[model samples]
Target: MLALRRSLIALVAIVGVVAGAVTAWVVTEASDGGAHATRGEAAIGGPFELVNTEGETVTDQDFRGRYMLLFFGFTSCPDVCPSALMDMSRALDRLADAAPAKLERVVPVFVTVDPARDDVVTMAAYVENFHPRLVGLTGTPAQLRAAADAFRVYHEKVMPETYFGGDAPERHEKGDYMMAHSAYMLLIGPSGGYVANFKHEAGPAEIAAGLREHVDAS
Candidate 1:
């Protein structure tokens, strides 16, 4: 009985050690970056159905056979959104200057987080402020939410009272609001899968270099 008891205790100890090792491996994988990071297919980018500035319904499939430079922001965003969009536009221009032929292989997309105020006409005019080839998209709340979820983009409307030190903006009405959102320029492959993303701090040259690397790889 004593020997049997000892054997059972040893087995249990072995099992616990194995479980601990597995858990540690998973944690390391989750935290590790560089080549060890796990990037599964369709993990970052997923299917989404949205309406373009032209008032036409489109999906991820529509942009298939070409790369997509996707960005999510609202027209009312005064700083971060505009800076990122400018960087994206200049990146494309740089790429074009180096290899004009590569321009046709990629499409720059702007998705609005505030669809309530960003209709087709608004998006059309907003996109014109950036690159001519840039495409702006908006849709219903449900559609926008779905797209945001797929891309892991977070956005929320900030009331006027929250804009300053607990003081509302002058003439701010009930409907007046601003948005707080994640600002990252996502790069989708020609196969409609996520390739990479650039932070808003990345300048035009850096973004262009990174984008050029992907285009060359493709």
Candidate 2:
């Protein structure tokens, strides 16, 4: 009985060590970029049903056969959002002169993360400051969540006090909150597949170059 008990304990110890080793290997592989290594393409961009600036219902299918350059942010964003949109607009303008055919196939899109404050009228007024062809989209909270999740976007509302700490400015109104979101611009292929992403700091020239490259490749 003593020998049998000892053998069982030994077997359990061996099994635990093996399990730990397997777990460690998986963690190392994932950290080393093996998490996305197996897939042929990154899983990003999917079907989204939303409302356009004109108060028209739009969906991912509406952009079929056309490439989409999309960014996610709130209209009220003071810096990052406007900067990214302007860069995108400038890139499209460059493409218009450099590659008119490619520019025709591309569409710039802005999706609002703060649906509560960014209604159709607000989006309409906001997009006019960017590219002439820029399309602004907004929807209900649940609809927005679905779209954001499909694109792997992260967004959260921050209050003045929480964002500015003890010296936070007084709120202009009860709904006066700020939205924090990812600032990367995404390029989607004509068939609605993920192509590439431009960093938040990417300039208009860089974005245009990327767009030209990917559009030509597709």
Candidate 3:
């Protein structure tokens, strides 16, 4: 009886050690920047209601299971917006072409700041020029302000173009207005929290490299 009792105790001890080791491994992986931390810290992911390019309602919960790259810009912007989209599309293409499976796990999101100018039809037409997988969103001015607030972005319309042209104001396009804003892209994980936010002003290769760096690390 004594021998049997000792054997049972020893078996229990072994199991305890094994379980402890497994737990440590899991914790390390979850915290490792070199690993794609599932359910990462709560910063980026949250409930949001946005209008899709199709004029349909899209909520934050719709993107619960994929990595999302979100950018805030307007279609009417003279330069930054289009250039950023093009760069992002190229990066995604490179990532996809390299690893087809990654395509299923990644989603690119574009949120327009000038909702007044980016109606469903307008946003749709702009998105169509980019990759087919790209998604565009815009809503009411209230919705826009709310979303921008959530992301902590600054954007406003500017007027009085060329007012200082030697007292003879240059002719404006009448309907042409410029958006004063900054360009940056936010990257989020499956947990819907921000993992990385890279500046959209970066060159395509740099942006792509940053993405690859993170993906590879993860």
Candidate 4:
């Protein structure tokens, strides 16, 4: 019940610095505060067919006109998933008063890598705890795999018995037993291409700063 309040800057800062390592390259790729390049190998790619909490046929196209903050995780994750989402929610809320329409322009998403267990119903219930606007999506195994591969997310099923070296249920089942996954926060522009990326562990303020920069430009 405490997680929903969450949270980015301007155009050139958002679109142009496709490079996480090179400052000049970012300048070249983007104008004063806008991205100039059309397309490149980015965090946004691949096609997916998943259903949103509303049970609608949610696909990548649904976000055509807006910025998308996408993350790969599940409702059952014990550590990274909840912590990150909570931080994100809190960060977004702090920015709300400053940029009333920013949240509307940039949507946050939570997609379960474990679709077999994270169906529409479960995903829906879980996301609502974090933020009213956070969307949860899931689908058949096939859909899940496609999305994961596209995003370079890695998840492995470790049976409960073998999950931990033998830890408590609250420690293992809620965590170690769950699928091991790669966490990445992605930003997709209106054209459905990767423009920036915030790896898992990026602070909420950093994430909010990134989003603010990118969303304002678009």
Candidate 5:
């Protein structure tokens, strides 16, 4: 019985490691070049209804005639979220300088994973700090989940203790928690299909180039 239990534990550990490795490989490949090349066959992205910064309900259909550059994150994120948004903003700026007309056809959107704290007013204020053309979106938990699911985004709330460990500061309130989420930005075509993904590490110029290629082709 003891031997069997040990064997099961070992098998579980191995499976966990393999799953993590596979996930990392998929994300890396998607970010590198596979996403663009496999866009036609990729099943990512679909219909979603969410609220805009103006408190008006909006759907994916509203963006049917234009390309959508979508990102998922929260406003209060201390580092990753803000950095990713800044990179996206810079990429758009680069695109504007290269192809002004194409820039007009692409809409950069920020969707908050923490809808409870990211109301329309909060979204509006947060998005304004990024690209002028960037639109902020937040909705009820169910609505946001639908949108996140459509894009295969991963997000989970983590308490400071779990996220920061024993070194966690005392300044965090009892309800204060952080979100762990996927950092990739997704590109959707004018007809509401997945195009490609940009890794968080992808720089402004690379993203701009990708945008120019896809927008020009579309």
Candidate 6:
């Protein structure tokens, strides 16, 4: 749980840098802070459909035979999203070197919470910044919301005061908003059930270690 708190701290810091009007408390309040907690498997993960970067429709069933490391964020997220993707890539690379066979059974997935701005092409380009095997997914707002709910992930957009020129509640451009979401990397079992999760503070080595432990146990 401490690790999750740390992840939230880093996410809030990134949001603050992008939109000075955001505060750490605002982000903390937005997050449920229990994404990676030990809860009933029923509490997380379920059926959902979305489009991959290749414009192909995918679902939880498509990844049924492999472990899924999922992260929810947006392409517009300047720091947390990119950093988490890089961490996932590095963790996968470590796994490939240490346990090649186990690595083959793991899949890293990125699902965009802000689908309005992240289409198939945008997700394709954004995913390229990380691992070659990473799958980037985006879909309609309703579709994305379904997936987020299935995962019990929290996400919401905040219109920063800076966009309003320091005026309180003034109208701003539609795209001038920041997202506050959970920043944990969720690990789903091969059967599409909940396994465990790694907080951003865990970094590459810790993430790789967690994957190795879970994959070997199964």
C-alpha lDDT score of every prediction, in listed order: 0.77, 0.79, 0.68, 0.69, 0.80, 0.78
Best by TM-score: 5
Superior candidate under lDDT, 1 versus 2: 2
Ranking by TM-score: 5, 2, 1, 6, 4, 3
Best by lDDT: 5
Clashing pairs in 3: 34-217, 45-192
Query: How do the residues 135-186 of candidate 2 rate in per-residue lDDT, one tens digit apiece?
Result: 9999999899999878767777887554444345554455577775666788
Between the candidate structures 2 and 6, which one is better when assessed by TM-score?
2
Off by over 4 Å in 1: 1-42, 163-175
Query: What TM-score quantifies how close candidate 6 is to the native fold?
Result: 0.77
Question: What order do you get sorting by lDDT, best first?
Answer: 5, 2, 6, 1, 4, 3
Give the distance in Å from residue 216's predicted Cα in candidate 5 to where it truly belongs. 2.8
Q: Per-residue lDDT tens digits of candidate 3, residues 1-218?
A: 32342344334334433343343333234344565424324233356788998889997788877878778888876556787789989888887766656666778999998987899999999999887899999999888778765554556676635222223235555655656554667677776666676664466677666666555323
Q: What is the Å distance of residue 162 in model 6 from its true position?
A: 7.9
Q: Which regions in candidate 4 have their CA more than 4 angstroms from the true location?
A: 1-39, 160-176
Deviation of model 5 at 82, angstroms: 0.6
Question: For residues 78-176, could you state the per-residue lDDT of candidate 4 as single tens digits?
Answer: 667888788778767865756767777888888888887898889888998897789888999888889877655666676545433344355444444
Clashes of each: 0, 0, 2, 21, 0, 0
- Return the lDDT, model 1, position 70: 85
Checking candidate 1 for backbone clashes, the offending pairs are none
lDDT of 4 at 77: 75
Off by over 4 Å in 3: 1-45, 160-171, 174-176, 215-218
Report how far off residue 27 is in candidate 3 (Å): 22
